[model samples]
Target: MSGSILNLFSLQGKTAIITGGTGGIGLAITTALAEAGANIISIEVPHDPASPLLRQAIEATGRKITVYDCNLKDHESIRATFHAIWASGSVPDILVNCAGITRHMKVEDTPVQDLDDVMAINFRGTYLCIQEFGRELLRLQRPGKIINFASIAAFLAQTNISAYCSSKAAVQNLTRAVSNEWAGKGITCNAICPGFIHTKMCEDLYTDKEFSARVVARTSMGRWGEPEDIRGLAVFLASAASDFITGESVFVDGGIMGR
Candidate 1:
């Protein structure tokens, strides 16, 4: 029984393609997967400034690493990237869609282009990656896992980030829609809804003492969540432990939703 349980979390033979792996939470997830024995394929947009540091860190783990410059909004580019992965003879067993963007403007002041930009990366990009990965898994007749990044904003509204909130809400449902369509074919799709995690994305907001105190006071944990707070769940969702879980949006929001 102990051996069987241990096997549940083992990712020894899996390969993972993680979008936005150079980012804070994404890098933490990548490290967690590597520690559990999965090879890493870190994908980012072209000329990402953080890639070099991320590559070095992943290298320190002694796990296999491949870097791809992928633009998820461009269907042609996405197809090519997946094709290149297949050509390398390392089909992905897991995909972590952590790539997203946000614009901090109220609906009244937000420009149309900004909304479109957020949707292009956060919504359209996630959908395309899921679609392409599902195709590849279907072609190979392999069971696969897909983890999408939603946010606490998917359920609750906050100020000045309407575009981001809307995109995440779409992603929350997209996870369900994809699971309904693909679960019978041996793919499990799910989303992780995180709250005010301390990432580069939230640096400015978290630095504001007044706003920070308000969030912390409201949070059941009374502290901001760190990137590392997300890694353990990521490993579980990507492993055999969560084979029965699909089409669900799990919250890692420090009880924000409960409140």
Candidate 2:
């Protein structure tokens, strides 16, 4: 079944919708899916263009990367972006919800707006995108995949970022709820729970030698995860290889959870 197995992981002729696909872990996932043979449609904020290096990387994969500007925090913007994507004649086969934000503040000190902002983008945005993606798939009677970007915080609470932790927890369960409703409709929903990956989101913590050392010591692998560490699973979950999987949260941590 070697050949069949390879075929299962192939994404030829597929199109993927990836939010925040210009940088960091999102960019990693975009390149991975493209290299696996899928065309990409990225949704980013206005005025945020993919860097030349990133554009070249995707171009080198012999796949196209088209970006649309949308404010994930805005309901109308999300809907309009999807409509624009469909109007452009691309039928997305996969959806990767990789955009989110966090702030390091004590719950008592965090303003209500801060918590709302975190939830607006991390949880509500994910749900809205999934809502739009699911509608199109169901309307066309097609099979598709959804890969949500959850965090280790979803499983284990962390210090000073209560809002982010709670939002991710919501996303983890949202994956299950979505799968239960849409799995029978030829759509698969799941999440990727990253543990201490070396991305911009964790830069603040990583620069602190003491905290970084503590993270490394706690993780069984004795190292932090790189963005590229997510490539294989991103492709697998986006391809037919994971057809039997849904409502699951797979970790790409460097054995952090194992300890």
Candidate 3:
């Protein structure tokens, strides 16, 4: 209320580092921040296929996009990537932990390896990014925001994808832990728990007409969420508008979990 809404959301001159910038959700967030005048730094796995198009999309918004290849599971690589960004004279003011993977398997059927893999990226990887990002911001003596890509599953019980759900649960608490430690300083950590959005992760589930219908019927919106549905919230969290907000997991679930 103190500032113009436009100014509140403007990320002009801010630099954001996003993990999984080539994916559906990540791409939407990248474009949104870019349109709001923030320079983009996308952290992705080596040899990612979606790099070219993701780059073009951000550039099309008339903002700069730099891609960094880092394995989140490898602390050294993650550290080196941030070092390179700092060496290049660009410090990240925002960190978006959007890189996540899920496997659709029942609890009984979930393999030990699958759980490790999901936890590594969805949980451990997020922790690692927050660690490095916090280190950079504290060193620079600046304020920063961290937006983690959690899921509706974090709060509600769901069938299959046990590993994914548990990992997201970890993410929710992790967001709290990071914020608890950093909010008093110069950093605010939060999460966006998306519902059933139409992305590569849901392609197979969408193919199951009955299951899809059930999910839709449960939601008051009676529709699936698009990548576009998440862009505005992503911008708000990354901007000064949400300075007072931290350590909470907000939902964009289209009323699915409300029931």
Candidate 4:
């Protein structure tokens, strides 16, 4: 790539706030952004053991990383966490709402509480974080980027995960709604729809030999995606290179969507 193209992807002096940045795909995103030269503010659950490991990983890239404890399911907690982040003088230029949960129960068998739990974290939590992050950006009149983690489930109805599918569908639209409102204000919002990646969230499913076979056969690439596979798009969406793109859901599905 030319110097001009590389420069567009540089995140030097920028700071990013990522929810669920301590493990799995979230850790991949944290590494990608940090390697791109952005300082990191990782919002993880209280006392998550992975926080220290995440700190060590980012520091290895020669970038600063701060970990904050927050319960994403609570709106007040999200607000207070953002406030604390600001008070610490790391006003972020990017926000990645990568925190989510899923329940693998059929619709008829799923409890109302389970449904509520999925929606609370996947959809409501993302919305609350965006609201808080956007408020700060608007107040400062600064340009910003917002990346939400939607899923291939948002586009397809998978069996036994009705609540997870529904929540991600809401996230897909929410990304567009935010972009419509924020794009002209110098803030671009987009969603990333991942396919069957080999993350802990789907470890059981992937470990099932027959199920894993089906996934590999279905994906044109003939393999499960790794956390590292998410890096390039994550970097692009967080950087100036994607400034013209907003309200779009880009899939890094290794051709599963194509199939």
**For every model in order, what is the number of clashing pairs?**
0, 0, 0, 0
RMSD to truth, every model:
1.0, 1.1, 1.4, 1.0
In the range 13-72, model 3's lDDT, one tens digit per residue, is: 999999988999889988999999999999999999999999999989999989899998
Positional deviation of residue 198's Cα in model 2 after best superposition, in angstroms: 0.8
lDDT of each: 0.91, 0.92, 0.91, 0.93
Compared with the true structure, model 1 gives a TM-score of: 0.97
TM-scores of the models, in the order given: 0.97, 0.97, 0.97, 0.98
Please, what are the lDDT tens digits per residue for candidate 2 over residues 6-111?
9999999999999878768988889999999999888888877565555677899999988888999999999999999999999969999999999899988999
Which residues of candidate 3, in runs, are more than 4 Å off? 1-3
Q: Please report how far candidate 1 places residue 39 from its true position, in Å.
A: 0.4
Clashes of 1: 0
